[model samples]
Target chain A: GQQVQQSPASLVLQEGENAELQCNFSSTATRLQWFYQRPGGSLVSLLSNPSGTKHTGRLTSTTVTKERRGSLHISSSQITDSGTYLCAMSNNNAPRFGAGTKLSVKP
Target chain B: ETAVFQTPNYHVTQVGNEVSFNCKQTLGHDTMYWYKQDSKKLLKIMFSYNNKQLIVNETVPRRFSPQSSDKAHLNLRIKSVEPEDSAVYLCASSPDWGSQNTLYFGAGTRLSVL
Candidate 1:
């Protein structure tokens, strides 16, 4: 079974600040995805990066498959950016998610 | 815009009650999955159907079952719900069963068992 671990269980930032979240897996990952979930809301896929780096809006996802690790960076965070950021990895079966990083942006 | 749609955004029932959740994906994906998110926000995979065929069935309780009539629809049924069953059930779909595919998730159904 693959295990995904996310760092900084909780993070707080002021508006316009940058945030970085880390994810590490215990096994080789064939796919990696970053998701955002607002309070009591559905999970929204942010980025899918199996290897190398990917960017969407103010978000950036970088994955090093060989290292079994990935990262999500949020730039110029806003109050609406407050939510839980989840990282999931999969090898050959269903994806496994980490505990998720709770982000709180203060206005 | 969400391509995956789930019915009954929320459900409330007592223990031993039977409950069902419906999920449909307009993305025309060949694989669908059900995941449970607990109060602590820990997400766990429960079942996955590929082309309407059961592919990944985690070590969940036997009372939990997944039904799929086609590649675009996947449903979950709980014969005897327990207090522990109170959680958010998310339905997701991917292009295929391949690990490299990205998953699109529905809004999810929040279950409350009393």
Candidate 2:
């Protein structure tokens, strides 16, 4: 079965630090999306970077389609950024999601 | 603007009880889907509806069924739920079936079966 794996299962960082989360998939995909889930909150679409690099606010995503890997980069992290980051890839039929990387930013 | 919305943010019930989760999308998408996130936070696809028609079944158990009143609404109903069914259910919608389109997700319903 095809699977998406997220790295570091958990991450803890200090305020103003940087964090990077990696996502690797074993299937061929043309589209990949990154999402953020706050504690007891809804999942928010962060970036849909199928390939190359994309930046939005404090977050940046880089995806290498050939390598079947994607990474989410958070710069100068803040307490509010504490949450779970999920990675998903769209196959021909359905989209598969990773277990997600839990992030905890401290003050 | 929130394109997707789910009702009953939290639910608690016992085994053998029947429960239904409703999802609505204002994105005017042609495809809607239901996903389950287990305790380990592994999100898995259960059902998919495209233009009010079932497209993907994923060998889902008969106890779990997805119903759509219209293109904008897709609901999931479970009969005789079990403890293993306790998980977060997510509703999502996309403009089309193509990979070029991104999905919009709802807050999700957290279910706990005792």
> What is the C-alpha lDDT profile of model 2 across B19-61, one tens digit per residue?
9999999988999999998878788999889899999888778
Clashing pairs in 2: none
TM-score of chain B of 2: 0.97
Native contact recovery (fnat) for each candidate is: 0.91, 0.74
lDDT, candidate 2, residue A10? 99
Q: What does candidate 1's lDDT look like per residue over A1-107, in tens digits? A: 78999998999999999999999999999989999999989999899978999999999999999999999999999999999999999998889999999999998
**Tens-digit lDDT track of model 2 for A25-52:** 9988788899889877777889997899
Model 2 residue B38 CA deviation (Å) reads 1.5
Please give the RMSD to the true structure for each candidate, in Å: 0.8, 1.2
Question: Can you tell me which runs of candidate 2 are displaced by over 4 Å?
Answer: none
* Residue B47 in candidate 1, Cα distance off native in Å: 0.3
What TM-score do all the candidates reach, one by one?
A: 0.98, 0.96
lDDT of 1 at B60: 100
DockQ of 2: 0.75
**Could you tell me how far off, in angstroms, the CA of residue B15 lies in candidate 2 after the best superposition?**
1.0
